[model samples]
Target: MEYKYKLAKLQYDKEKNEELIKRQRKRAGQVFPKQLEVEFWQQHLEQARHNINQYFWSGVLIYFIITVLMITGDYWIIDRNFFKHDFIHSLLGLVNGAFCLLTLFFFAHYKILRPYYAYAAMAMIFWAIVSMTWLTMTVHTEVFRHQAMMIISMIYIMGFVLTGVKPFHMLLTGLMAAVVAMIMLLTLYIPIDVMVMGRVLVGSTVVGFLISKMLCTRERMIFLVMHQARLSEKINRIHAEELLHLSQHDALTKVSNRRTFDEMLDSYFEQARHDEVPLSLLFIDVDFFKKYNDHYGHQKGDEVISAIAKSIKDSIRHMDFVARYGGEEFVVLLPETDAHGAYAVASNIFKAVERLAIPHSQSLVDSNVTISLGFTVYKGEADIFKSDFLQRADQALYRAKQLGRNQIYYHTLQVEEVL
Candidate 1:
C-alpha cells in the first residue's frame, strides 16, 4: 500500500511540472508582442513632436514678415482716396496687421496651437482681400488703383495656398476666381475696355500661381538645407567624442591605455607639486602569465587577461587611475596617497585577484592565478626626478618578481641635491 501511494505521488508531481513549463512558454510569447506594440507607439510620438516643432517656428517667421510688410505698405503706398471714406476698409487693414502680429506672438510662446495657427493666419488674409476689394470698387475707373488692389488680393490668396490652409485655401481660390469673373462682367461700367479687364484678370492669375509656386519651392529648399546642417553638426559631435575615447582607451581591455596614463600622471604630478601634496604609483604584473598562455590557447589567454584587467579596475578607488602598462601588466596612479595608503590599496587588489580563483597549474608561485605589485610614494623633497620616480617603481616590481612573485613591495625615494 505504501509503494502504491509513492507511485501516485510521483505521477501528480510530473503533471504539475509540465503545466508550469507550458505557462512559462505562453508568457515568453506574450512578452515579445507587447514590446513591439510599445516600440511602435514610441516612434510615432517622436515623429509627431518633430513635425509640430518645425511647422510652429516656420509659421511664426512667415507671420512676422507679412505683418511688417502690411504695416509698411499701408502707411506709405496706398492712397486714402482709393478707399474713399470707407472706414471698414481702413479698419480691415489694421485688423489684418494686428492679427498677423498676434498670431506670431502666440506661436512664439505656446507652440501647441501650430496647426490651428495657420487657420488664424488665413482669416486675417481673408480680411485683407475684403479691404482691398472695397478699395478697388470705390475707384473702379482709376486704372492704377484698380490694378494695385487686384494684385494685392491675388498675392494674399497665394499666401493661403502655400501654407496648406485646406478649406480656406479652397475658399480663397473660389473667391479670387469669382472676382476675376465679375471684373469680366463689369468691364462695361469701367472706362477701360473689355479687352483690358480680360488681360488684367489673366495676368493676375498667372502671376499669383507663379508667386505661390516660387515661395513654396524656396521654403522647401531652405528647410532641407537647415535640416542637413543640423544633422551634420550632430554627426560631427559624435565623431569627436568617439575620437576622444579612442585616444584615451586601451584597445584590448577598454581601460586607460599607456599614453593616457603617462599624460595623466604628468598632469597630476604637476598639481601635487604645486599644492605641496603627496602622490603614489603602483606597477602591477601578472605572475606566470606566459606559462598560463602556453598551457591554455591564446584565445583563453586573452580572456584571462581581460578578466584580470577588470578585477584590477574594480579593486581601485573611483578617484584613482588604472591603465594597461603592456603585456600582462598595469599601472595605477593614486593622488594624495602616501606609502601606507598605497600599500593597503595594492594588497586589496592582490586579494581581489586571488578571489577570482582562475586556474594556473603551471604558475611558478601558486596553484591559483596571482599578481605582484610595486608601489612608490612621492612627498615633498623626494630623492627622485619624475623619471627616477617611475624607475624606482619599476625596480621594486622587478625585486618583487625576483624574490618569488605574487607579493607587494613598497619603495620611497630620497632626493639629495648635489652641492
Candidate 2:
C-alpha cells in the first residue's frame, strides 16, 4: 500500500511538471494583437536605452572623480615617501581615465551599436575588470583592507541594482565575478587570514546574487501583467468598434441599413433646420422589381440590389447619405443641397444604373434594369412635418411609376409669408 501511494505521488508530480512546462511554452509563444508586440518591445527598448545612457554618463562622472582623487593620493604618497607603488597607482589612474572616455564614446553613439547582447556583456566585463583591478591593488597595499571590503560589498550590491539583465544572466555574471575574485585572491600572497576571508567574501557574493535574482523576477512579473492589461484593452476596443460597424451597416448591400438611415435623416434634418440650409431627401424604387425577381432567382435579386447600392454609393458625395431602406427601395439624404444640386445627384445616380445595363426582359419600360427617383427639397420650413415631406416625395414616386418606370420626379417645399 505504501509503495502504491509513493508511485501515485510520483505520477502526480510528473503530470504537474509537464503541465507547468506546457503552460510556460504557451506563454512564451503568446503575442499581442494588431502588431502591438512589435510596438511594445520597441517602446521598452527605447526606454531602457535612454535609462542606460543616463547610467553610463553617471558612471563616467563617478569614474572621473575617483581617478582624479587617485592621482592626487598617489602624488601625496610620493611626497611623503610612504609607498613605493606610486608609479603603479599613476598607471592605474591613467587606465581608468582612458576607460571613462571609451565608455563615453560608446554610449554617445549607441544608436549605431549592433549586437546589443554582446555590447552588454562586453560592458559588464569591462567594469568588472576595472573593479577587480582597483580592489586587488587596495588588497596589495594592505592600508585600507576594511574600506576595500566595504567597497567590494557595495560593488556587488550596485551590480544587482544597476544591471538591466535577466535573472539568469545576472546569476551568471555574479558567478563569473566571484570566480575571478577567488582566483585573484588565491594568487596574491597576502600574510592574513586568506581562507576565512575568501570564504566570507564569496558567500556574501552568492547571497547578493540570490537577492538580485529575486528582485529581477518580481520586476519581470509586474511588467508582464502591465503588458497583458494593455493588450486586453486594445482587443476590447477593436472588438467594440467592429460590433458598432456591424450594427449600423447592412449585411447584404454593405450600405447603411434602415435604422442608421432613420437616425441620420433625423439628425441631418435637425442640423439643416438649425443652420437654415436646404436639405433634400430622395426616395428610390427599383421599377418592376417583383417581376424581375420572379424572372430571376432571389439570389440574383440580392446581387442586383447590392450592385445598385454600390452604384448609388459611388455616384453620391461623401457628405451625402445613402441607405438601404427596404427590399428594392433606397433613401438618400443630401444636406446643404438646393433643387439644382439634388437634381444633378439624381441624374448621376440614373446614369450610374444605366451604365450597369443589367438585362431585365420582365421590365415593361425597358429591356434593361432601371430605377425611378422622387425627391423633396425642404428650405428650412418649421411648418412642414418630416412625415409630410416624406409623404410628398413618396407621392411623387407613385406618379413616376404611374406615368413611366425609369424617370425622376421632384417636389419643392416653398414657405410663403402671410403678411
lDDT of 1 at 307: 89
- Where is model 1 more than 4 Å wrong at Cα? 1-84, 91-119, 131-148, 154-210, 218-244, 380-384, 414-419
User: Where's the lowest-lDDT run of ten residues in candidate 1?
Assistant: 28-37
On residues 1-419, what C-alpha lDDT tens digit does candidate 1 reach at each position? 44445546545544543443354345422211354335433443333344545676675678668757755655454456654443344445445555654553464336586545555545545544444444444442344455544556554555444334333253555366547555644653534445654555445545555555444444434433444455455556656766798889987798999999989989888777777788999999999999999998788888888988899888888999999989999999999998878988898899999999999999978999899988787774544468877887887798789889999988667533110
- 1-419 per-residue lDDT for model 2 (tens digits): 44455556545544544453355356643333335445544544454445656666686788779878866765554534435454465555457545644553464446666336334633554465436445444433454454456555655555555444433455566566666665665676544466755654565567667776565445444545565555456556656766787799898998999999889978988888788899989989999999999999899899999999999999999999999889999999999998889999999999999999999999999999999998888777888788877787777677778878799988665423110
lDDT of 1: 0.65
List CA RMSD, all candidates: 15.6, 10.5
Top lDDT model: 2
Best by TM-score: 2
TM-score of 1: 0.62
TM-score of 2: 0.64
C-alpha RMSD of candidate 1:
15.6
Question: Which 10 consecutive positions of candidate 2 have the poorest summed lDDT?
Answer: 28-37
